[model samples]
Target: MTRISTSIIYLILFFINVRFVKNQQTTNFSCEPRPTQADTTDKLQRLRAHLVNNNLFAYVIFSEDEHGSEYVQLYDERRAWISGFLGSAGT
Candidate 1:
């Protein structure tokens, strides 16, 4: 009975430690400003031309949201346009 109780205590401590470590992890991510539409357009146009020359299809998507207000979406088109990565929370 004593050994069983000790095992349970160890299991509880292990779970608590796991939870604490998980909670301490940082959730922040940031990126540099995106490029202008003209820049993106120029790059996309070049990419499209290359694709057409190679007989390939090119697809692209850009998105942005307003900054400062969490209520608004930031303008992140340049980030996505150049990096091809999207922030789920618009950070």
Candidate 2:
């Protein structure tokens, strides 16, 4: 009886682990389209030069304004200016 219960418990745990892993893999899948070379080539070159001049390895651009507002004005669209992605998500 003890061995039977242990085996059942192990089987339940194994299925739960498999289910969790599958759920994680599904959540990791992205449908967003990747930026092509035509979309970012020239812009990235200018950005890279600016980074090198400032001795910085990377820079993060946000779509928010001074008030933390996602709906920003044309002047505050820094991320769009660089990446040409005017989506709601910020970089």
Candidate 3:
């Protein structure tokens, strides 16, 4: 498929995934950084528990970059991956 069509398809799937995640997860997906921080922290706590079970003390988290790039690459879609925010401006 062409680039535009591919992007459109991805967008459609993104919305569907967002809906499913929002319903399944207690935290609502948001672009607001502060709100998402709490959500991420909660998730991290659960992850930390898993890590502790495996005898780990810490883990690294790489958040999405917010440079002035015109478009966000599929692989660098950390914001979408974490909080389900479709907008690139979201951190």
Candidate 4:
């Protein structure tokens, strides 16, 4: 009856809202502030030095919590110190 019709309308609205939210989250990420030649060279040299100092044959990976529970700012230093990715989920 009227109650069932209202329930169907509510369900449709709920699904539409969910789809809109999901679409909003879809994004394409690109590196910002593209590094200058000198900056790139410096980063390369720093990476080399890190590898040499650590005697590492393979790149090291690191990660931080993505739950947004901890202070993500605190991990900025570690990200700067590392060569590879530093993310909440995957490194």
Candidates 2 and 4 compared: the better one by TM-score is 2
User: Which candidate number would show the highest lDDT if scored against the true structure?
Assistant: 2
Best of the two (2, 4) by lDDT: 2
Q: lDDT for model 4, please.
A: 0.48
Candidate 2: where is the Cα deviation over 4 Å?
1-40
Model 1 over residues 1-91: C-alpha lDDT tens digits? 5845755665666556655534443433364445732234456456656755786443323233444343334344555565455565322
Candidate 2 whole-model C-alpha lDDT, 0 to 1? 0.61
- Worst 10-residue stretch by lDDT in candidate 3? 56-65
Candidate 1 all-Cα RMSD: 20.5
lDDT per residue (tens digit) for residues 20-91 in model 4: 543453334474544531224356466656755796433433344455345656555354444433344433
Model 1 spans > 4 angstroms off = 1-38, 59-79, 83-91
**Each candidate: what lDDT?**
0.48, 0.61, 0.53, 0.48
Sort by TM-score, top down from the best = 2, 3, 4, 1
Which has the greatest TM-score? 2
Clashing pairs in 4: none
| Candidate 3, 31-88: lDDT as tens digits | 5566534345555557646755796533422333367366657887665554455653
Residue 80 in model 3: shift from native, Å?
10
Model 3: how far residue 85 lies from native, Å: 15
